[model samples]
Target: MTNSAKPRARAADKRRRLATEAARVLHEQGVERTTLADIARAADVPVGNVYYYFKTKDELVLAALSEHSAHLDELTGRLDQLPDPHDRLKALIEAWISQRETAARYGCPTGTLAVELDKRADGILDTEAGTAIRRLLQWAEEQFRALGLPDPDDLALTLVSGYQGMSLLTNALRDPDIMTRQGAHLLRWLDSLKDTDPAA
Candidate 1:
């Protein structure tokens, strides 16, 4: 390839790596607590180099939020591959529960980020940070729709809210079992919904 193309490719790779590392740092530490230095250290770059990629911490966080969105898409895309709608829904719960330990340690990645960003004084970051949660809820709604559930909208809220509530408790209580237990109940609730669905 041309020298100019090589430099551009390397720059893009470095930016992506920084954003990914920033997302992880933000997840492990809250947005308020994470610093550009923390992200740079995690990405193994000089702290000054962070400004070359992101002029402000807010810009870096926006990149991190974008990175988080990509990750959620990758995860939910896999869940959508399951043939059965109910199975797909169940798989979503299983995936969250699989991260119970991490959630217990650092709170749900999306949930915590949503909560923190919602507190911004200007409010735009709130909407940006909510993207991951919205993606999850919308995807769940689609799965319920495929199940022929009449209340896909309400059911989607119920499903996501339950997980969010359980995430809070799991973190507050510092018990991963809270998520596991709630996930079981959620799974059974999904099964019972099959009974209510005439299509089932």
Candidate 2:
């Protein structure tokens, strides 16, 4: 590669790494507590270099949000591979349950971030952070609609809310096992909805 191309590529790599570390720090510490220096330290990039990619902390936060959105899109793509909508929904629940230990320690990253950002009076991070949850709800709603549910919207809301509620409880109780138990209950609930519609 040419010298100019090499530096540009390295800069891109550094920015990507910074965004990833910023997302992790934001999830663990919340936006108010996370600083660009923290992300720089986490990414092992010089603190000054961060300015080359992001002019302010908020920009870094947005970058992290973008990274998170891409992650959700990737997850949705993977879930779409399952032909059965029910199985797809179950896979989503199982995926969340599998992260029980992390949720118990740090809460649900997307949920917690959304709540935290929403609580901000300035509304700066509101739209971007909110998109994370909104995207999940939309994906769940699509699955429910595909299942031929009469009220797919409501079912989608319930599924997302239920998962968020369980995550909140798991974090509050400091018990990862709570997620496992709740996951089983959710699965049973999903099964109960099966065959509710003859046309489905």
CA lDDT of every candidate: 0.91, 0.90
lDDT of 1 at 20: 96
Which ten contiguous residues of candidate 2 have the minimum total lDDT?
A: 191-200
Native-to-model Cα distance after best TM-score fit, residue 14 in candidate 1, in Å:
1.0
lDDT string, candidate 1, 15-111, tens digits: 9889999889999999999889999999988898888899999999899889989998998889878889899999999998998999898888778
Error of 1 at 106 (Å): 0.5
| Per-residue lDDT over 1-200 for candidate 2, one digit per residue giving the tens place of the 0 to 100 score | 99899999999999999999998999889888888889999999999999999998889988888888988899889999999999999999999899999999989888888888888787878788888889999999998888888788899899888899999999989999999999989999888898685555
Candidate with the greatest lDDT versus the true structure: 1
Please give the lDDT score at residue 144 for candidate 1: 94
